[model samples]
Target: MRYPILIEEGSDTTAFGVVVPDLPGCFSAGDSLDEALDGAREAAAAWIDAALDAGMPVPSPTKLEDARRLSGYEGWTVGVVDLDQALFDDSIERVNITLPKRILRRLDDLAAARHQSRGAFIADLTMVTK
Candidate 1:
């Protein structure tokens, strides 16, 4: 998925700013164009993840041409950030894994303490680490 982003050019004394129009309130900044775009990608991914986790629908990206025509952002440079399609996928699949008995026990204990299922606990941990 390629999401269109608007970048405000930066000067020596300022940082570049980027905004992901598809995802409201998702924005990022950096000292250079590359850094700004990278930050935008991360911001967009995090925005999608949070929306999915909260049971909210993630908006599809508006076409680059259409996004460019939107009001405001007049003079900002336009660019596309290619996001992994998997970021928008929320399907669940079952899998089997082998773990040391002690580790399994500890995992179960931690999950129980959090009042979450083992799978839920693992998923939460994976997201945090990512």
Candidate 2:
């Protein structure tokens, strides 16, 4: 599912961050724009996993009428995201990965940079790993 991801470049040209508004629970960052996007995709997967695990209904993308209802709201902007159900249902294989402490730390950092919980991050990695 593709979400409307907001990307902002940091002070360093290569540094960036992304926020998925619909899934306010998810965020991501990277050393470059491309990395940020990749992180965002991972973050989205993680967020969805967590939500599903908790039995929380994932909110559908807001339509134009939904945005219109919020027109004139203060200090906020809205963007729509299109999440394909087919993409959400596609899960390939699962592999058990036991990494060293350093690599785990890096994974944690990446997940945190995206504002995702470790469980969600792991679930995402498990779902899409080739």
- Top model by lDDT, which number? 1
Per-model TM-score, in order, reads 0.82, 0.50
For model 2, the run of ten residues with the poorest summed lDDT: 71-80
Model 1: per-residue Cα lDDT over 1-130, one tens digit each:
9999999999999999999998999999999989999999999999998898889999988998987887899988888999999998778989999999999999999999999999999999987885
Error of 2 at 8 (Å): 0.7
Q: Report the lDDT of model 2 for residue 54.
A: 66
> Per-residue lDDT of 1-130 in model 2, one digit per residue for the tens?
4455566665565467766766876777788777777877777777776677566877666554454455333333334344546545636575677989999999999899889987778766876763
Candidate 1 minimal-lDDT segment of 10 residues: 61-70
Backbone clashes in model 2, listed as residue pairs: 27-114, 28-114
